[model samples]
Target: MRRSIVAAVVGVTALALTGCAGGGDGSGGGAVEKATIAIAADPGSLNPITNATQAGQEVSAYLYETLMSFAHGKDAEGLLAESWTESTTEVSFVLKEGIVCTDGSELTASDVKASFDYAADPETASPYSGVYFPAEGLTVEADDASRTVTFTSAQPQSFLLSNIGQMPVVCAAGIEDPASLDSTPVGTGIYTLEDSSPGQTYTLALRDDYTWGPGDVTSDTEGLPKTVELEVVDTEPTRANMLLSSEINVAEVGGTDRDRLESGDLFTIDVPARPGLMFFNQSEGRPTNDLLVREGIAGGIDRDEVASVSTGGRGELMTSLVSSFTAVCVGADATTSLIGFDADAAAASLDEAGWTVGADGVREKDGAKLELTFVYPSTEAQSVVAGIELIQQQLGEIGVEVTPAPSSSYTDVIFQGGDWDLIWAPISTTLPSTWAGILSGPFPPDGGNWTYNTNQEFFDLTAEAQQLAGEDSCDAWTAAQASAIGNLEVMPFAESTSTLYGAGVEFEVTTNGLLIPTSLRG
Candidate 1:
């Protein structure tokens, strides 16, 4: 078991979030016309194509509409596209008739084609391009008369339908004028962006004409809030307090606040996630580049303690990087092959690797001190700090000096290849294919492989997995994951339930943790 800091940070905006007093409370008093929710960060940009942050995704959940709905089951349901047929290298979608954009323009297949084409363009530089749309050799065609959109990829992608279907589609107008979409959203979602106050608040108004929701859902569904107010509340305790007071309808509360929130009459929607994971920098010259040092560090630390302390004993020890919501193959126990805690073995490993304890009690190798910079996200709960400190002491006992670096710009540090030996950032995704690219692809500046992993066995297994569809690829993916875990390329330590506490609100969250706007009822 291992635990590290968050790779992402809270958004740029900061605003005081206060709940309503009487009428808006969740106690079934007066009309439930409005729903106020607390968002941890202020989404800097409203453009769905460019921003992929948690705050952005939350906001976009109301403003943008995807081709298909992401559900807990293995298959994806239709949203924008009524029906879709997919093959290894090709996918075709038929637009549902009567689907209209916020501007009252009928959503045509041409709009879908334009959106994909724009996102696929290199000049657009959308981070989601390769993940949602194929990064290379993607061809799209549309027939407005037939309401059909066809896509063909150069390489065979097993999960093409689910991947491409989930990409938020911009309206034709937004596609033509990308600059106009910077702060304003133009899609066919169930809600429209009513107003935005940059770092303060955001307002979304429900659309009365939105009848073509996922499955048989319609705008007239009971409990759907007429209006949604998103307020930036950085503190988890503050958000929890607001929820308890009925000042806010919904808020995500973590750490010790969860126990208090659960004791109340409020409803909870739990989003399963891997919150504490450790990634070692394998780039040249980094101390962690040495396999023996990684093994030494892994052996010295008690992962069970890290998980318990970090999550206030609310987290379960994770066996894999894939979270429960999106894990298609759950029986694979690759984590069992990872190095376990053994202090004696840790010391032996360090000594055999030529690191000797110096007068200061710090190890020295090649006349250089065995010191490392440990980085983590600055916005994590207080419990996470305690967990990090525990790791520092455990490593210190093994003669390794660990300097804790809490950063607000954790993603930037990882992307720019800053000075870090180990980092804590949980990777959350809807597919196993995503894990492969994140762990073994081209290193940063070229791609998202932050650790600079060069595991040939992992790469080969992942390649084999990508060629097969559905459960047929599970064996290969699990093998690939085991290879990475056994090599200590990354360490998944703790998993937690991200509870969204709601007072008067009733809602269901997607597998990856975004609140399904259509499911919001108050």
Candidate 2:
């Protein structure tokens, strides 16, 4: 799943430039064949299995192909796999014929198995394996004759197909040398990396042999750009200015910049995203480990104020951790009573926990101050900054001292470091069961449960939900969410739309806010 929001920044208005318009052939007179788009940060590693940043995932979408792709409110569509079958605990897929890797080798079922095996191996240390392919009793086997790969799970995995289908399939070369993938990546994607400067820019050239794109996308698709350039512009205002001057064609924009872009000839696409979420460190040593403190923090934040500031009054206040767009877990208002704007109640809850207000107005227990290290992504998006500031103020009113830490790359700080009390990162996934894996997994060094929640009921409900499929499992999913909310395992405050603005180009943004490069037009 893609994570992180685009940074919004302020900048002076730049003069707009007119770019040549053309079709896919590049034959139209003076038509521009190359296009540029701005991504938030440099994808330090191009390896699909290890790359955790949102910007990296966006760029990987072009350099790699997943077995299946999820369409909003629709069934998963085949990409590398032309057809698939599933049982309660097993899923089988048939690879498309004649698909070749950029290295000129055939893409066989064994390669798929090898890729998964690499990710599943703990030695590889892939952050996505647990959520995508649970290690417990998971196995993969390939049938060369039929070009088929079959996956079996020890326990019932209702969403197995959806989970594994979205994983990016790499060749043996990438699996063997994961470290080298940071600079050199080889995959059977629609485009191949032509050139790149670590933190500056990345260039991709279209692959004419790419015939296995998701849905209606194919090599013969119309309006596809000949070459794509990803400009690493961290500032939203700089990106907006670049778009206006035609220095770039597409970018993710927010705040007043979005309105300015929409007011002009640029096209804007709004994709649903979980805006603001608070993740607590529930480990033994963290202050947030105390249930009352966690509940107090959840109850203290004003959702309306956060949502209003986060989206500039353009987003909705979320009542549940699960987004409304989630099909199976629709209408799950799990956090209804668990989280609300009640400063007095929050203060009282903290006091009941034996954390008394000190002379400094900050709560103290056993000579320890109630101080939390709240970290958020360092994005120029002022609304996100404002929302975090508001959360700090609200928590402060309840006697919790918050130290705001802005990170240029949150994944590094989250997965590698342990010195943090809370993190304001919202996870995005199409399947609700994904959340189950994240919540139940071991904490930090052992697994991906960054929050370190040890709630048995939450783990049980999520596991139960994973065992069943369709509407029959909605109750369990809802219960799992409720359990988390009730325990203050996570605080989901607002849901906002991710807006992408394009200047000289037109393309569709996926339901999850991913740009469909195959849909790009000049």
Candidate 3:
């Protein structure tokens, strides 16, 4: 999800180095005394339940603990819950012993139940509730004596284990006063919010008793920084400058600045992402509703050129809508055969669809010109604007007049107003099954079928996939992706690889461009 950036702050100078210190619990030795990282924006909300931005989610990953987590790759490993079992319509998790919240309260099954219940409540209105608690019957029951939490769904859900496991859990305090959680977040994780200056800076201190991290991550983990600081530096150039000057240890840098950073002594990590997709408004009364027009728009743009310009030739041309990092179904194998860059074919398709080139070089049919409004969010990341401009130029070649619309409030404009011919937003998820929610339903909030587009075959395949668990459902999911691609319902271009440059620290990025806190080392 896109994060909110309030105001850009001036860059900081390097601080004097301090001696390495042990963890809060005196566990590991030879850890970083202190460290600072630059984030592109303010998280807006510290609350994990309602915080949908990538920045918020990244920060919250440290403050909140999930039942299970993605361990380096797609494998789901235990975090709060040590072991879990799943049936067709229900999943049960056994909580680890001796887990405690930051407030000195024991972490129990009741806390887990309360967290999920709050998110599922309609009054709470969490954006992630539908995704995390997707079961139709949707019931969360906790056995305090057994220290187990079980979720029961009315209908069969193949992705139940993953969906429930990935959700961030909150303490009873956060569940009771959800409103106050916007600024003061409380959870059981590796770090606790120490101090904050809203849009300028925020700090987190390591938790002494945090031993329930996913995989082998724990408070005693070697090379874990004692204190972490997040400074808001919205501009990419400034972030790159800070990293080069040793003012900040790590920051995500892109475009031309990335070349300069890579040449320096900085260590870089690249995580794959779906750079952008052209979402056509398939609702009635829109010109792009026609299949030929959608196909023409898809075939006109060269994915390679766009990827090159967007990432300064560092990104890969997308073969499918789903990222390769996704565990389920590596990628839709039929993507190459489904979509390609063929300007001649695009023009021919438009001509066949009754749109002919007029005297002014724009196509027109029935006194209407083939003009499209391409919308994208305005951010410091240069690729977003550059990619949209390339798309405009590419579509113009096929007799389509493209107008670029850069909006600060992209979600409001696209989801609420429904105001554009094409939107350049990519949906990134760890699991391919997440697409089931994104591709389903009537429209937004409920599901991401914002275009009001529908395919009976695709829906049927996805439904079938949901009936089975794990790799057993891979075939159906692959078929669903193929059906969507063949129909040109969603046109994905450029597989974005985010590169983060660090001065003295080394870290790995998750698929969604989030740094794994436990992986950071001095």
Name the best candidate (by TM-score).
Answer: 2
Give per-model TM-scores. 0.88, 0.91, 0.85
Residue pairs of candidate 2 with colliding backbone atoms: 8-380, 8-381
2 or 3, which is superior by TM-score?
A: 2
Best candidate according to lDDT? 1
Question: What Cα-based lDDT does every candidate model obtain?
Answer: 0.78, 0.76, 0.73
Q: Could you tell me which residue pairs clash in candidate 1?
A: 4-424, 5-424, 223-521, 223-522
- Residue-pair clashes per candidate, as listed? 4, 2, 1
Deviation from native of the Cα of residue 357 in model 2, angstroms? 1.4
Quality of model 2 by C-alpha lDDT: 0.76
TM-score of 1: 0.88
Regions more than 4 Å wrong, model 3: 1-30, 73-75, 122-125, 215-222, 344-369, 415-418, 445-448, 508-513
